[model samples]
Target: MTAVTTRPGLAPRLTALTKIVELGPGRLDQKLLSEASTLLTRAGDRLKLSSEHTVVALAGGTGSGKSSLFNAISGLELSPTGVRRPTTARTHACVWGLEGAAPLLDWLQIQWRHRFARASALDKGESQLHGLILLDLPDHDSIRALTDTEADRLIGLADLVVWVLDPQKYADASTHRRYVAELAGHEAVTVFALNQADRLSPEELAELVIDLNDLLRREGVEHPSVVPTSAVSGRGVDSLKSVISSAVSRRRAAIHKIEADLRRLEQRLSQTMPVGQALSAPATVDEARRLGLTDALCDAVGVPAVGEAMENVYAERSSRWVGWPYPRWLAKFRPDPLKSLRLDDVSDEIRGITTGSVSAQAAEVSNAVQALADGLTAGMHPVWRTAVHRAARSRSSQLPKALTEDLTEVAPELDRVPGWWRLLKIWQYFLVGAFVGGVAWLAVGLTVPGQLPAALQLLGDSAALPWVGLMMASVLGLGALSGIASRNFVVLGASRERERLEREMRRRVAAVSENMVVEPVERELGRHHAFYSAMRGLSG
Candidate 1:
């Protein structure tokens, strides 16, 4: 912390960070503004507590001499230093006296310990480094996962990090892959310390230091300060102390930590803000004005003037349900006279909206309703109905999907009607032909005198009349059979048309409902709605 003025543009950096957090990237800025507000609040808290002492954590892997260096920096063997794989289990917090820093310590859940580094215990030279909270964290590669977790937790809260490394493991693949690589851009608040330099000769130590510095530089550390030290010989302890004091004096590490927090907050804010394409509301009933479905339905049912015709038809039909039939003039005066007639003709309007053949439109609407209900439910719990309106708003697209699904749903149900009806109608003609033939046979059998006179009554009181009656009976039976056949055919045609119309109407309705209603609502609620609402109950 050499008190060198802050690398100009601190304000701009703060502004950019605020923008990023408040409104993520451009496309989703509006969506993330609220989240940005939350992050900004946290940043403000951190800034408001500027009087707090900065926390600089010492982080490293097993056998990295972090404990040894921690002792050297604090000028006391506070941490157990040995050849074991892991030395520190719990964290050791070394606090320097500074006013109004208690809140920060409490936030970190750290137990305070006085700094007692002597001014004479120097390799290069010892210096008093005040206004800093130094932490010696547990080994990142400790055998216990808990130790690693502890180190990571402290690192998140620390304002600066001093990464301690042994020459041999400095370039360890795991170290670089997991740790150094992630903190590349965070070099401002990070420093590299090559510990155990006593292991190498002076020349070798100097060379190793140069190589280490070069390695850090490649990892985005511009002019990184790499110090060589040995707890056994007190090699570079003084220089390390001086460096720590300088950083503390200038609060470089503190600023860097705040910047990092800003970056993180900004990233989070982006999520809350709107960016890119503007959100679109779902299509409404009015939007399909150009579809002309209503007109189409009116035309199909042969009632082009549907609006007025519907009123009259309804009134006419309603007139039938009432046992006390009203006079036509009187019925006209009744409220909703159309209801009295039961001649509501809005089916055509329904047909038009469905946008298909009369039959097709009916089917579409039926299918749409079924699908919308199914989709609105599906996996949803019973209690989920409470959030339904919100859910609809969020998943606007779902409305359309449901509608389309229903359009196809009723087609199969209506198809279940038997196909034999048509054959019956054809059978009626054959029966009529048989009756004519029978009559001719009977006339010949009787050998009635000179072709029975026109319309003359024969066999009146005659014994042969009984045989004629039998013949007539047989003819009548044949006619009855023909009648049944005809009825079947006629009924079958009507039935088929009825089913077709139903299906068409249902499908059209579904399409309209989905496009006009469901899609927009779902889109709006999808993002913020809790996917697993507890109110959904045990079923959920």
Candidate 2:
């Protein structure tokens, strides 16, 4: 068969495949990508589009008359032919040109002893087959390991393969299943020749051709061109030569071969990727699950203890402002709640104060993360599932440290005393002063005699002993009332402060979850999207 027309976008398709292979570092399957890279390199090195040479290999099973066909097509006795089971032990190359096909033959690794060149003046009609490197490969079923290896190697690299088959062994199961069926997508560069046609009657030859066509169809080759040729009689040699001439003139054998190889690679790599659109993570974290994670991290960061300490600190400061003066002085001796906990220090560095509940909290956070990852990868393929799981756990080792740091950074303003507290403190001080002054006045009246001077008598009459008692009683009553009213206000303020600390702690924990887990998984999903888009371009 002649080579098909050159594909319009072959260069772009190959470039796309190259790009996909380039993205193989940590994202794609290592082994498969490595194989694809090697295939691409080989295709690039072996098949040069401007080389002006087309390598065609004649391959067949034992007793298929492949060597006879090779000689008949080349019009020379270049390949040894006999009635042996496996005639060719090694590959033989017959090049039509003098100098240009040397590099191509060297790539084929054909020994100089086995290489032949056609005479320039033999026949003008044969000039149409110039720049053709015809090769006779060893039998596919050869017992010799070296011969079979050579044949397999050449078949893989050949731009065009002409499968030679004897009429008797044309329908052999091993040949059809192992060889022909494997080249299903390579039909554009493949030709089938039924050799030794002289052995059969004309009617028998026609029937054999029909049977071979049916077998080829079953092998996934649609509309195969099977030529009936007798190498001994040179019956259909011209038709086979015409096919070769057409392929050489078009100079698209290399492109077609490379294109077919790329197609096969795409098929293999597709199995590793998901089928339709790419998968994406949930837009927002699950609220119930997020709350659970926050609670866990709060426990890990000592938020409950911190909140309680915050409330105690608020009440302690309030007492200093509203309590009785004598007891308020002693209140300074009591330790501040936040200072006792060592959380009052303003430092950017994370403290190493180990909490007994952190390990359990860490486990809870890990479980929530695992559940989230599982939900995200629920309907994805196994490959993508593994990727998602890896992404979710990418920062697991740093979760504890990250949560601690964030919680400490977002710690609430526990040291800020409200403005009302200062005003209440001034009122308490004034009431205490008034009580002291009243007591002093009464003590002076009891110790000293009645005033005899005119001015002193008038002042003493105005500030009588009963008047001092009434003033002292009034100061005590107001002070008690003020303390009673402020107690409820202080308690309410402490409760509000505790709630504010809780909110701050929860916000910090939520940020940790997003950074450590959610973002990494989403980035991986983005890579999957890019891979799917690249694969779609391969089909086009």
Each model's TM-score, in the order given? 0.48, 0.77
Q: After TM-score superposition, what is the CA distance of residue 27 in candidate 1 from its true location, in Å? A: 15
For model 2, which pairs clash? none
Q: lDDT of candidate 1 vs native?
A: 0.55
Query: Evaluated with lDDT, which candidate comes out highest?
Result: 2
State the local distance difference test value for candidate 2.
0.75
The local lDDT score (0 to 100) that residue 261 gets in candidate 1 is: 53
Indicate the worst ten consecutive residues by lDDT in candidate 2: 346-355
Q: Candidate 2, after superposition: displacement of residue 496 in Å?
A: 8.4
Clashes of each: 94, 0
lDDT tens digits, residue span 28-84, model 2: 789988877877786777645335778899999888899999988887788888755
Give the TM-score comparing model 1 with the true structure, all chains together. Answer: 0.48
Write model 1 residue lDDT over 1-540, tens digit each, in one string: 122233455455555545434322332445454544554554455455544356788898888899889887776777777666444357876666545566666666665552333334334343346667788888877778777787877776677888899988988876777777656457667777889988999899888888888887777556677778887789988787777777777766666765665554444433333221212311222334323433333233333233334333332332232212223336557676444444344544433434533333344333433344344443433333334444434434343344434443332231232343334434444545666676776676557665443213455445666676687776666555545454454445544545555546444654554555445434422421322111111011
Model 2 earns a TM-score of: 0.77
lDDT of each model, Cα atoms only? 0.55, 0.75
